[model samples]
Structure formats: structure tokens, C-alpha cells
Target: MDKRVTYCTDLEKSVIMSNFERRGWIQVGPEDEWNFYWSFTQNCRNIFSIDNGYRMNDNQIINHFPNHYEISRKDLLVKNIKRYRKELEKEGNPLAEKMEVVLPSGQVATRYVHLDIIPVTYVLPADYNMFVEEYRKSPQSTWIMKPCGKSQGTGIFLINKLSKLKKWSREAKIPFHPQLSSKESYVISRYIDNPLLIGGKKFDLRLYLLVTSFRPLKAYLFKHGFCRFCTVKYDTSVTELDNMYVHLTNVSVQRHGVEYNSLHGGKMSVQNFRLYLEGTRGRSVTEKLFADMHWLIVHSLKAVAPVMANDRHCFECYGYDIIIDNTLKPWLVEVNASPSLQSTTHNDRILKYKLIDNIISVVVPPDGIPDARWNKIPSVEALGDFEVLIDEELMEKEENGCRPTKNSRYR
Candidate 1:
């Protein structure tokens, strides 16, 4: 087997350890070795974890996290998205509304984009040009444009005037947007009249999810995750970027919300809000919340099974953000392969640590296997970037591959 050690990093690493401990992982060591190492076991076999985010199998450590989303493979996530988009539409779901377009012309990369549109919905939107003319003819009615694949609620817009659309198509024709609209693909929809409310503010539900077994396809939902509210109060005031109160769910933006309050508003654990919503909005809303959560994960997984079932050594976790309209119906907002691992609070550390702990336990062999003790660092300078865990200075090198270098220096 290729024995190079692997390291994985996310802000959740620290918290994941606590989870490990909670699950009964034992920590053994300060062993004389080149790098820090830790071991834990389950089902009679030992599983390993590295203290840093380095992976033994990859060439270079990624300088950034959250930039890449790990799905079955590089192009798999987008392909899976296409499958799910078809599914929701086939079921005749109300959110199945769509748009049509003629492109500028180029190869279409289906794996990266999937939008919902229709040839025949009860309230049909004719082809792109007709939809535009109808809007012009009506003078008062408007439509929303949502682009697939972009995240954090970006690229969705409300177009009221024909001039704005002329500008959009013009922008799409630019050389820089080459792969986007060569013409054949587009998904347009009527915006929701009522996005759900919290603190009198509009927001979406961020439910955390886990895939325990993908071969047979098993998933587990944490009882809670978080609720991200748009920072502005609802208004016809024109949804500009700043009116985040109705548009953004990112904690980074919402914290600056007009209705923003760090202590009691922008962020609230799902468990806490379960009570708040019930006391105010009534118990039924919360009931639908759970129902919607289950449907989303189940349908999303089913949509992507064709690809996931055929892979091994690939990851299977996902973070799905779902929005519930005023009617309390759920709509899939986006799916994340590498969801945020940055622990935002003490609870974050606790939850994250436990998650990693579970991950390691699953990897350890069920029977006792050999322990490959590794190398040692020559000086404190080697441990760079950490304050509490490292000492400073260098000394010796060893040849055994499992022994620590023979000395130290900090004075």
C-alpha cells in the first residue's frame, strides 16, 4: 500500500477531536517521531489521524479551504445536479417553473449547470423572447433570473425593464463569459411571493447532513445546523445587494444586516429556533420543516445515485441549503460538497470534533494491524503556524523513517 501519511484540515479539526474523545478514541503519545501523530481504534483496528491539514497522498497542500467541494469526483457533482433537477420537475412540483434560451454557441458543460424550466406548467412562461415580450406588454408584472452553479445566493436577479435584460444578454456575450450562455440553457422563474420569516426577517434553513453509507446509500441528519436570515425587513424597495435582509443568508453578510443583531438575531442554533418558531409561528411550521428536510436529502441522493454508486475512495458528505416559501414548501437552494468547516462558535468546535472522530472510527480496521510510527522534526521552526503546540529550534535527522531526530533547542 502507498504508505505516505495524509492530513486533512478544516476549522472543524479541533472540535472533531472532542468528538473523537466523546466516541472513546484513545490518545497515545509524544512518540519520538518527525511529525505529530495520533491514533484511535474501533472494531478492533487502528485508524490514524494527523494533527495538521496535510494529506499524504496529495502533491501540495491547498492554500485555501472551502474553495473546493468534494463530491464523487471532479465533474460528478454537477452531473448529479442534472439528475435531481429533472426529478423535481418530473414530479410536477410547483417550483418546477423554467425558462428557454437560444445560445451564442459553444460546447455546453452540463455537469456544472442544471436549471429548472418547463415547456408546460399550468402557468407557463413561453420561450425566452416571449417571456420578455409578455413582461413588456404587461408593464407591471416582472420576473426573476437565477443562474445555476454559483453559490451563496449569487447571480439571482429581478428584471423589470427590457433594458436591464438587454444589458444582461450583452454581458453574457462578452468573451470572458464564454462557457456560460453560448445560448441553449437558461432557467427563469417567478420569484417567491413569500419567503419564510424569522425575527420578522426572511431567511433560509441550513440543514447539516451526513452520508454514513453510500454504497447502500445511507444518510444521517443532525437534529440541527443553523438558520441564516436575510438582514432587511421585507419591502418592495427593490432588492439591491444591500437589502440583504431579504436576499443573503451568509453569516458574513447577515451580521451586517439592517435587522442584524449578533447576540440574538443573525445566528441561532436550530434547536433554539425550533422553540421560537413554534411559540410565534405555531407548531405546524416546524413540523413541515422536518418534513422538508427529509425530502430534500432523500431526493437529492436519489438524483445522484447513478454516479455515487460507482465510486470508491471518494467522499460522500454534502451540505444542502433549502428555502421554504410562504406556503411553507421547500425549494432546494444549493448543495455543498465541502461545506464550511470553520467553527463559528464553541458549539462549532464541539460538533466538528465529533464529526471527525466518527469519520476516523469508520476507517480503522476491525482487527489489530501494525502501527507504523514515523519521523521526527529537527527543530521548533518546523512546527510553524501554531503557538501552543510547538516549541522552537532544530537539532538532528534520523534514517529509520519512524524515529525522532536526536535533539532540541529553544533558548
Candidate 2:
């Protein structure tokens, strides 16, 4: 009997298709009987929708959760994190510690220092009055506005004055109303004007996280993530605010700039970035920075685990975009459900190919079969370039003073 696993993918990308083919997995159409489906977010939604009535067998698995938007959507993500911090604070958790934050206008304000990983953000229209109140607190501060449903830096702009949002208020129509409207919504965040610049250019970290489950939360962080750099030099001047090349580090947007370097795709390996930080900022600070990043990543996942669908048959590889300020403080920008698999350069293609390969090895069982009911743990060898970010089961054992088995030391 042929025991080969059959797989199907809606994405025609070489990185994804090549990985499946390399695994000797048989290709099948979406409508065909397949044990694995590397589907788009839209297809995943359709499959899990009650109206569709599509059901997965015990031996089948897919690439996304049914309700990933609880953490992926910009506005929803902020809302969930805010709620998470409040709950922690109510419980008197140390993670919810508050501290003084010095504003741009030299005013000191108390904020949830530990839990304030992301920028001070508010969902637009509904929070318009609150945003106005905060805006008045720091009139000189710059804020960035982004459409909740859009990505790839499509509808992003920086504003220092309330007058700049007049057009948006007019479009939203329900300005300052407490009731949420059905119109296109947005999230405005205080911009990180003093970003940590390397070679006089601004950049952001693009880290990949693989989540196998959310309930007994299991997650892995890929070690080969990279930094995306803006094509133009870093500038905070109002004149340069309109130039995306100077502000945004997204490859899709940067590729259009004249100075865009096709050879390197304007990206630097995370390893190289760490080395640079270690050299300039010292090793201890660099280590602490990374440790804090991991802490934030785990907490961010924890923030949404309660609301996540936590489907057993689904695993998602999330792209975490982070920006570090000049003070060496890393801020969570947003999370992407479907991170771009499109390769920009030769090295990029190689990195993504290996990423897909490792993802398959971790998600699939040892017998080269996709089994949703199997224990979600993968051996260290199977993990490849991925490291365990969190395993709640192991955590629970540790909390109860139970020693983890030798094989379970992957964390």
C-alpha cells in the first residue's frame, strides 16, 4: 500500500510548492481527499465556517486557525493586549507593573511600563475623543494612522496635528461617537520617531513564530529571521514623512523606491543585526534586549490565547513585525496571519525554502504523516532552526516543581 501523505495548497508560490514536492508528498486538488492543506487565510475561513459545514478528519491538518484575527488584526490586537494587561493588573501580576514615561513635551506620565510593549494606540472613530484627549497631552508628538484591514504599508501616514485627520473624520462620518460604526475603521498609534538606526537608515525586525496550539499554548521561534531596512535614510522631518522610502521598511513598498537595492533586497540577517548590537551596545544589553523580545512575544500570544479558536487541526506561522527605539526598547508593531512568502533575492528564497521545510518537519509526525491528534511536540532534531518559545505543559510541570524529562529540554 502506498502510505504517502497527499497535500494540497492554494498558493502557487515556489517556496511552498517546492517544500511539499521535496517531502515526496503527493499533490492533490483542494476538492480532493488530502491529509494536509497549505491554504490561504480565506480558504481556512471557508473551511471552518459553519455555513460551509466542512469538517477535517483526524489525520488532516491545515496552516491557520479559524479565528486568527483576534491577534492578527491591528485594532483587535491592541484591544486584546489592553484587556490582557488590565486583567494582569487586577490580579496584581508583576508583568503589569506601571512606571513613569517621559513624554515628548517633557511631561511625566504613569503607564503600564512592563505591559506597554506596543505603542499607545486607539481604534479610530470610536476612540476619536479619547485619542484627541491624548493628542492634547503631547501636541508635539507624531502619530501614525493605519487602516485596520489593510497591510503592506498601503494606508499609513504620519500626523502631528489634528487637522491632518480631518479628511479621515469626514470619511468616517461618525466622528467622536462612542458607538462603533460599520464603516472602515483605523488604529492610530504614537509613532516611534526616535528609532534605532543602523548606518543612518531605519529598519524593523521580521520574526517568524510557529504556533501549534493556543489552549495549552505551544510555540516556536525561528532563528533565521531578518531585518527589513528602509531604502532612504532615517528622517523625522515633516517633509520626509510623506516619503515612504524614508519611513516604511516593507519590501513591497520599498521596492518602488529608486534607491531600492535588488541585490540584497534591503534586508539584513538577524544574526548580523545581533552582532552589530553586541558590538555597539555591549553583549549584556544585547542579550537582555533579546530576552525582553521573547518575553513580549510570549506575553503577546498569552494575551490572545483565551480568545483564539485553538483548533487542533490547525497550525499557524505568524510574522511578528517589531521596531526598536533608540533607547533599545522593542515595540510590537503588528502581527501578520499570512506573512509574504514571495522571495525578493536569491538568499531570501533560500531562507524561506528552509523555513517551509522546517515548518513541515515540526508539524508532521515522524512517520511522514499528518496527524492532528498526535502529540504536538517535535523532537529537537525535527525542530531544525526553530527553538521552543513556549510549551505550557512543560511550564505547568516546572511550576509544580516537577523535573522535565531529558527529551523535553528543547525549551
Name the best candidate (by TM-score). 2
RMSD of each: 16.4, 2.3
Q: If scored against the real structure, what TM-score would every candidate get?
A: 0.57, 0.96
lDDT of 1 by residue, 52-160 (tens): 4423221211111121232422223444655567666788754445555432233221211123311111111124554554454444444556554444446556665
For residue 396, what is the lDDT in candidate 1?
Answer: 17
lDDT for residue 36 in candidate 2, whole number 0-100? 90
Clash number for model 1? 29
Per-candidate count of clashing residue pairs (backbone under 3 Å):
29, 0
lDDT of 2: 0.90
**Residue-wise C-alpha lDDT for candidate 2, range 89-203, written one tens digit per residue:** 9998887899988886787777986777999999987888889888988999989999999999998988888987887676657465657565678899999999999999999
| C-alpha lDDT (0 to 100) for residue 156 of candidate 1 | 54
Q: 57, model 1: CA deviation in Å?
A: 11
RMSD of 1: 16.4
Cα-based lDDT for every prediction: 0.46, 0.90
